[model samples]
Target chain A: MTATDDRADAPAASIEDRALALLARTRRWHWAEAAFWLGAAASFALLPDSHLLLTEIAILGLFALSLDLILGYAGVVSLGHGAFFGLGAYVAGLTSIHLTAEPLTGLLLAGVAAGLLGALTAPLLLRRATDLTRLMVTLGVAMLLYEAANRMAWLTGGADGLQGVMIDPILGRFEFDLMGRTGYAYSLVVLFVLFLFARRVVTSPFGMSLRAIRGNSLRAATVGVPVGRRIIAIYTMAAVYAGIAGALLTQTTMFVSLDVVAFHRSADVLLVLVLGGIGYLYGGLVGALVFKLLQDGLSAITPQYWQFWIGLILVVLVLIGRDRVPALWRRAVRRGGAGA
Target chain B: MLTILIDGIAYGMLLFVLSVGLSVTMGLMNFVNLAHGAFALVGGYVTALLMNRAGVPFLATLPFAFLIPAALGAVLERTIYKPLYSRSHLDQVLFSIGLVFMTVAATDFLVGSEQQLIQLPTWLQGRFDLGGVAVGRYRLFLIVICALLVVGLQYVLSRTRFGSRLRAAVDDQRVARGLGIDVGTIFAVTFAVGSGLAGLGGALGVELLGMEPTFPLRFMVYFLIVVTIGGTDSLTGPFLAALIIGVADVAGKYYVPQVGAFLIYALMIVILVLRPQGLLARGR
Candidate 1:
C-alpha cells in the first residue's frame, strides 16, 4: 500500500494527509452517478404514462435509503422501520387535515414527530443486546403502533384508513394530477436533494466513524469513536428520512392507512435495500426501481400469486449467494481487465 | 374468570407445542427462521385435508400430520437449510421469509383462500362442566395432550444421551465437534422433531387458531415472541413464555377487546428491555 501511494503522491506525506486524500477521492462524483440521475430526470418526459409508478418508486427509494443508513452503515438491524414511516405518514396526514395544506410544512412536522419518537426509542436500541432482541423490540414497537392506529378509529379511520387528505401543489402552482406528473417531479426533486445529502453524509468523516463502529464497535469505542452516541444520531437521522418519505407518500396519494405501519412495509424496505446492495446511497434508489418494476410486471402476469414468484426469487438469490456478489463483480471486472 | 384461565392455559399449551420447534432450531442452530410457522401450517392443512376429504378420523390423522411435516423438514434441512447454518442472520431471515411466502401462496392457490375446517369426533366436541368451571371438551383434550407432549419432551431432552449431545452442541459447536459428537445428524433429527411438534400443534390448534392460507404470516410474530421471550437454552423457558403470552392474549382479548394485541406487544417490548437475553438466559 505504501509503495503504490508513494508513487502516486509524495513519499513524505503524513498518514493523516493520505487519509484525507483518500476521503476526498471517495467524495468525487463518478460519471455513472451523473448519468443515473440524468436518466431519472429524463424519465419525466420519456415515460410520461408511468409518473404514478415513478412517484411510488421515489418514495420507496427514500424509505430504503433511511433503512440503509442504519442497517448498512451503523450495523443496526431493524425489522420494523415502518413504525417511523407510518408515524410520519399519519402525522403528515393529521397536519394537513387540522393545520395546513402547505406540503413542505407538513413534511417538516412529520419529520420532527418521527425524529422525536426515534430519540425516545433510540436509547432502547443502544443497550447491549443481541440482534434477536433488537429485531423483536423494533417489531414489537411497530406492532404497538399498528394496534394503536387500529383502535383509534375516529382519528386514523381504523381499518378504513385516513381520507380526504387534500394538499396544495408545489408553491401553490403545479397541482398533483391524475397523471401524477406534478407528484413525480416533486418526489424526484425531494429524492435527489435527500440523496445528495445522504451521499455527503456517507462520504464524510462521520460516515467513516459509523463504518468503523459497524465493523467492530468495541474496537471503535476503544479508539474513542463515541459509538453509542454516533449510532443514536444516525438512527434518529434515518428516522427523519423515513418520516419524510412516509409524509411524501401521504401527500402524493392524499391518504394514509394502517398498511403504512404494517410489518410488510418494513420487510419490503429491507428487501429493497438488500437488493440494491447496502452501504451505498444509490443502492436504495436502484433497488426501489428494480423492485417496483418487478412488482408491476409480476402482478400483471398473476395478480393473485405474484408473491410466490417474489418468494422464489428471494430463495434463488440467497441460494446463489448474496454476500459473494461484490467478490463476483470484482472477479468479472478483473477478467475484463485481463481481456483488455 | 376461571374459564378464561383454563382457556388461556389450553391456548398457551398449544402455542408451546407450535413454537417449541422454532426454539429448538433457533436456539441450537442459531438460525433466524421466520418460516417456522409454515411447518405448523402444513401440519394444520394435513389434518384439515384428511378429516374433511378422506373420511379419516381426526385422531388418526394426527400421526400423519406429524410424520409428513417431519419428513418434509428433514429433507429440506438436508437439502436447503444445511448451507445456511453458517450464513448471516440476515440471510437466514430472508431465506425463511421466502419459504413462508411460497408456502402461503401455494396454500392459497391449492385450497381457496377460505379457512380450512377440521371435523372433530363426537368425543372431542362440546363443553363439559368440570367442578363449576365450564370447559370445552376440545380445550381440555388439547391441554392434556399438550401437557403430555411437553412432559415427554422434557424427559427426552433431560434424560436421553441425544439431549446431552444437543446441549453440548448448543454450548459450542467447535468443542462439541471435537468431542466426536455428530452435531449434523443431531441437528437434522432435532429439526425434524421440532417441525413435527409444530405440525401437531397446528393440527390441534385448528379448532382455536383456525387454519388459513395466511396462517404463517398471521402467526409469525407470536411464534417469534415465544422463542425470544423463552430464550433458546431450555424447554422450560419457552414453555413458560408461551404460557404467559397465551394467557395474556386470552385475558387481554376477553376483557379489553378494544385493545386488540396492544397489551401483548407492549409486554414483549417491556420484557425485552428488562431482560434482553430472555426470561431465563444462563449466566456466561
Candidate 2:
C-alpha cells in the first residue's frame, strides 16, 4: 500500500538505494534457484528407476508456477487453471495425432491455443467481481470444458482417454524411451526455460504493476497504471505457461485424459504453491518436489487413502501459516542455537 | 414437461435446504466453507444407516440427521472454525477445502465407498397423476417439507429478534459487539442451524441424489452455484436461484439428455458475469 503511495514520491529516493532495492527484490533468492536445479539434476543420477515420477514433478512444478503467475503475483484467484492445462494437453495430443508429431511444435501450438483462449476469456472474467464470483466463473468454465471433453468422445476418445498419442523425438535428437529418461530431460529443460521467463516477467515493470494491482487495484489505477491490460496480459501468459506444462505431460506420458482438466488438478497445484509459499518463483519448484515425494511415500503405505493424509497436511498448513513453514524452521534453529 | 417441472421444483427445494447453510455462512460470516457438502453427506449417511440397520422409519431418522450435524457444526465451529473468522478469503478457502478432503476420505473409510441407498416408506413409494403430470408421492412429500422449512427459515430470519441481532452482527461485528450483541453466540447458533438444515436436506435428498463418499466433491459445485448465483446474503435469492437451476437442469436433461450439467454451468456463468453481486444485490 505504501509502495503505491511512494510512487508519487519516487524522485526523493537516492539512485543507489533504488538500484539496491531493485536488485534485492528481483534477484533475492539466487541460491534457492541454484539449489532447485542442482537437486533436479542430481535426482536423475541418484534415482535410476524414478524418471517417470521425476518427470511428473517437473510437470507439476510448471503447473504450479503458472498458477503462481496470476494468483501469486496478480491477486487473481482462479480455480480453473486446469482448463488451460487440459487444453494444451488435448491440443498437443490431437496435433501429434493429426498434424505433426514433433514435440516442440506441438508444445508451441498448445501454448498458442491456450493463450488465445485465455485472451478471449479474460475480458469476461476479469470484470469487477467478488472472490466468490471469480471462483464460480473459473470453476464453471473448467467444468464446461470437462463436460465438453466428456461428451465429445467421438474426437477426444471420451472416457477411454485419448489413446495412441505418438510424439516424435525431442528436436529430432533424444527419443522418449520406456524408462522416461528423454521425457525427464525434455520436461526439465522446458520447466527451466519457462521458470526463467516467469522470473523475468514477475520482476519487470509490468510485474511490479501486477503486484500494485494485487495490493490495491484502485490505488494502482489512480497512480496512472493500466490495471486491466496488465491483468489480461499476465492472465494470458499464465495460461500459456500452464498450456506448455499440459503439453509436456501429454508428450512425456504419451497419453491425454480428462483428468488434466479436472478440478482436483487445480486444487493440487494450489496446494503445491501453498506448501512452497506463493509470490516467490522457487515456491512452485520446491513445493512440487516435496508434494510428489510425499505423495509417493504416503501412497505406498496406504494406496487407497493417501488423499486423507494430503488433506490432513493441507489442514495443518492452513492452521499454521501456509507460508510460515520456513519461518518456523528458522525459529526452531535459532531456539536450538540459544539453548545449546 | 409438467412432471419434469414438478420434479425440478422438488429437486430445487432440496438444493435450497442443502445450500442455504452455505449461503448464510458466506453472507453472514464471509467465510468460504467448501466443506458444507460434507455436513450434508454426514446427514445422508445418518439417515441411511438408521433406516437400514435400526429399522427406523424413513421419517423418524430425519431428526437425527439435523441433530447430529448441528452438534458437529457447533463443536467444530468452536474448535476449528472459530480461529479462521478473521482470516483472509484465501486462508478460509484453503482450510475449508482441506476439511472437505479429510471428511470425504473419512466418510469413504467409515462407510465403504459404495453408494448407500435408502428404502422409502410404502406411502412415499407411490406416484399419482394429476391432469397428465405424474408426480411421485415422495417428491410431493419432499416439496411440502422443504417449502415449510423455507417458510420457517424466512420467518426466523426476518421476524425474530435473534434474526436482527444476527443481521447486525453480520453487518458490522465490532459495532454490533459495541451495542451489546453477543456476536459469537449468534454466529455459532446460525452455523449450527445452517448445518442442521443441510443435514435435513441431505437426509431427504438421498433418494433423489445418490449418497456416497464422493457426495461432497460431486455436488460441491452445485452448492457453490446456488450460493453464488442467488446472492450470498438473502434467503429468497438462493431459494429462487436454486429453483431456476434445478428446473433448468432437470428440463435440460429431460429434453437434451446428452449435455448433462452443461446448461446449468452456462447459466451460472452468464448470471454471475452480468450480476457479479449476485442476482439479488443488497444495497450496501
True contacts kept of 2: 0.64
TM-score of 1: 0.96
User: What DockQ results for candidate 2?
Assistant: 0.68
Indicate the residue-level lDDT of A48 in model 1: 98
Q: After superposition, which runs of candidate 1 have C-alpha atoms over 4 Å from their true positions?
A: A1-11, A324-340
Clashes of each: 0, 0
TM-score of 2: 0.94
Model 2 chain A, TM-score vs. native: 0.90
- Every candidate's DockQ is 0.74, 0.68
